[model samples]
Target: MNDMKELRILADACFSAQVGQALKRFNASHPEIQAVVSIAGAKDCLQQLKTGDVYDLAILADSGVAAAMMPDHTDGYYVFAGNSMVLAYAPGKILNAKNWREKLSDPKVSISHLEPNAHSVGYAALMACMLADSVAPGMSCTLLNHPGRKVVAADAEVTDYAFAYRTECIAKKISYASLPDTMDLSNPAFNAHYSTAKHDLTGDGKNIVQASAISHAVTIPLAAKEPEAARDFIEIFLEHNFTAQGFQPRSEIVGKSPRRIHAALEVRKPPRVQSANYEDEADVHLLQRARLLHRQQPAAEAG
Candidate 1:
């Protein structure tokens, strides 16, 4: 590999800015390697990869990775970062956090969400809404009619609220309410609860089941033009970039023959549960309602 070669990365839009910033710093320090990043929705990014669009590295949500894995497009992959869904809003627009559920239920307050199938955040948003509705029946219905839009656009507007990533809200300096672990889909302890809510994609009738947590997975594709550079970037990224940007970094490496390891590494399976005992009576009720709802209607019709 040449010392001055450039590396191309295709990443999900949610964290691309932060990733670009990290790569800029890496480029400055290393001088020999320059990296450029392209950001898009998770679905779009994965589709590009599937169609033989060349990139040295790819970063996307776990769901997207799952899709990529099916086609053997990934040489290796690992969970690098974790994030949770939140309700982002402009300052002073909604008062009284205690009445958030009521506010969301009120038809007077307009809400925005992302397309459920196109993006992980969108799918998580639907799960969050369904979780909210389970706590108080009919809460999800209020958001059902709300049109889906990009999170960036939603953040810029002064709408009542929009479903978004907590890290994104923080990075963009937007006011947001952190949802509970059970609803946010960011805690492994709530896997049982999270799995209860599900929604179907718009085009395909495939149901998007909620995972225990929202994670960012990075992979080096088999046909990468600069595999060595991709490995170097991953090493620098996992060691320094992710934690600085408010992501919970994983210490383990995954997939067959992971790239350079700066420290002792282990290949661990995705977390199925967390030790935290955060579930309360309300959580129990929420899960109960979710299971009941799932049984009551088909996923396609429910969506």
Candidate 2:
């Protein structure tokens, strides 16, 4: 009875590869805990927590998710990992990225993100708001009004954690390109602009509690067979081995990294989110624009 048992893990696909490696390492080191992992989006993970059903661990894209859940739940939570938002662009857009940036000063950029209600999307929404009003104000309307942002309303899971580059650019699919994870901070690029790679706004957040400027997100959740065990998982995430294994450590990657994809880019965090009101972040405008696209099939007749 002393040994931990029946561990359920819910996490975003972003950690799919990393978590598997972590668990393999965990099992070799500690065999007492039995863990089962489910690949869920950030919003799904949140739903798992709120329903009060049954789950041992739930890893998510943004700490804001846990913060929003227990507005008072701050004490027990922790930031296990850190990531930046990637301002992905369609292939065509990247072709003339600099021009696009200039055009994006308005809504012409045609930005896309996970549903706003999802944990990751919640954060992306915050970024969208900032992008729209930051430099010249209403600049992001280029992306926002592209007709693609409308389909999939909230794609938090896709934004913050999807392991692949294309998922974030799900809307303008068939073909796309992105900047590597080590995005440039000084002069940000548009292709796949991640948050950690974005530059800071200067003298705005450094005084508060370190800069969370990067657009990408990190996952945090009050998860575990016992919340304490979940807390221990966070501790492990922050441990040296997690970083040594090439997994981005919270310290080196978190507020510490000077990741700024584009000079004009700014990072965003979520306020509070609930998956119940989740929307789709599908590429509504990707029909002929490209090959892949989102679709809502008709409910089959009661045949």
Candidate 3:
């Protein structure tokens, strides 16, 4: 008897919407292969691999992190998209300010992000701060860290601003302001500027992870149970246009000669998607939605 085929994809929260959309398209084209997606912080996703957790594929925001896994945890990978960091602020917080810098430098304004050690965006925020500190001396803003989904929630209590992916702001329709290209970690042209900002994720005096232009990549682990299925998922993911999500194409970022280490996706007619249930639809919505507010739980009060 033929065993059931399944593809499990793990991705950074920033790519949640794109991965979700790709999975849905994969399902429609190849209903026989079961595909699923899980979202986590970039570091946490890579940590799972380091701990021997085998996933069919992992799409990470940081290309450097994925490169470190090469030939050991994963055999191959490719950059599919690029993104930039933006300052997402609460309504009426920065509306009257001259620019994002002025708002961020204001003593009364507060800033927040996910924990730097666990989340890629958090580390990006730290790097942004370091870069900002260089430009505006003695800038003191109240900085906070939320260990969970608190900072990205719809009702997030960010009094002034929070660091977030540009895609998140676009997907959720949140008001945001762009930082200088160097501070945003977006343009490859500012690679030299980006190099100046760095952080030691492990809190050790070593293994410093430097800031680089944010590029998203997908890789199949060496221990992946369904490598072929993983390739099929990647094919589907590449076929989709994510411009609406504020993502730049891989070709745009890396140049015209894109790398395809594996053989090109075989062209074939796609099978019609079968009818889906409410649960299936719900899963699609959950992944496609950028906000994590729905997953948040209210804090318990003291008895």
Candidate 4:
């Protein structure tokens, strides 16, 4: 495989910039390999793997995904990053955003969650159970089911429920709430590597509760003519610095770790001393989990 080539990357849209931003700096040194990315749903990345799309790298939920591929002697799954599961609230869900604690005491908090089929969202549900056990002893928060874009807006009021990563909720500007860092569950970490590559490209997470694995699976088609070059490109992404472009840091693969990795990372560096006017960093808190978006689709009437 020639060292001079750009690898085709297929990652979840969530981490599309992770690869791009990190690679921007890497390109300065390794001018040979170019990075071409194809963004899709994490589930779709799995389908692409099974169908032989031949990508150099991919990102997916850590424990939420499972797929079968041929055992390529040269490739394997590498743990690269970890994101925690945090409870986020849609601004629309809260009846009184100003008094969130009082609102939670209300009998009608409608939390939005992806269908259980969403691997990451499913793990988040598991965390909710843990949280319930610790808080009220036996009381449980109802995990409402909704579609990716489907929502059950309050008939005359607002619902209260948010699940997913902080990055996602903030990106959409939803009303978000999170647990203290001490309660984070950092076990399930993300994994990815070329089916034939030797390393993974990830730094660490600033978010803790939903710190699940995003295993980016990249598979070479059985008939891929340039398997060697493809493998080389995967190596570049793993070892290169693509984070300068706003790629959220993944402590595991990069360098930072511990549950506070994300929290600690959030501290402004020396160069950016001033605050208040800075642009928002999506999913800035590593100690928190993400809030998954879910809403029900209106059912169609039978003709």
Candidate 4 local lDDT, residue 125? 45
CA error at residue 251 for candidate 1, angstroms: 4.1
| Number of backbone collisions per candidate | 0, 56, 0, 65
lDDT of 1: 0.65
C-alpha TM-scores of all predictions: 0.74, 0.50, 0.74, 0.49
- Local distance difference test, each candidate: 0.65, 0.38, 0.65, 0.40
Off by over 4 Å in 4: 1-6, 22-34, 63-75, 90-105, 118-131, 144-160, 169-175, 180-184, 187-303
Q: Which ten residues in a row have the lowest lDDT in candidate 2?
A: 288-297
**What would the C-alpha RMSD of candidate 2 be, to one decimal place?**
16.5
lDDT digits (tens) for residues 1-303 of candidate 1: 456677888888776666766797678776776788988876677667877888888877654454445437775566667777877765666522344666666667767777666777887787887766544567666566545323444334566878887677666666666555557777665666677787664456543444557777778887788888887777776664444445554544465534666454443444322111222234544564466457556965869
Relative to the unseen true structure, what is the C-alpha lDDT of residue 140 in candidate 2, on a scale of 0 to 100? 45
Overall local distance difference test of candidate 2: 0.38
The sequence of per-residue lDDT tens digits that candidate 3 reaches over residues 1-303 is: 766677888888877667888888888888678898888876678678777987888878887677767657875577777777777778765432135555554556566776777788888877776655333444312222222223343244655677887777777777776655545677775576678878887778544788888878877787889887787787777876565457765542222112334434333332222111101223332332222222222332322
The number of the candidate with the highest TM-score is 1
Q: Rank the candidates by TM-score, best first.
A: 1, 3, 2, 4
As a TM-score, model 1 comes out at 0.74
Worst 10 residues of 1 by lDDT: 271-280
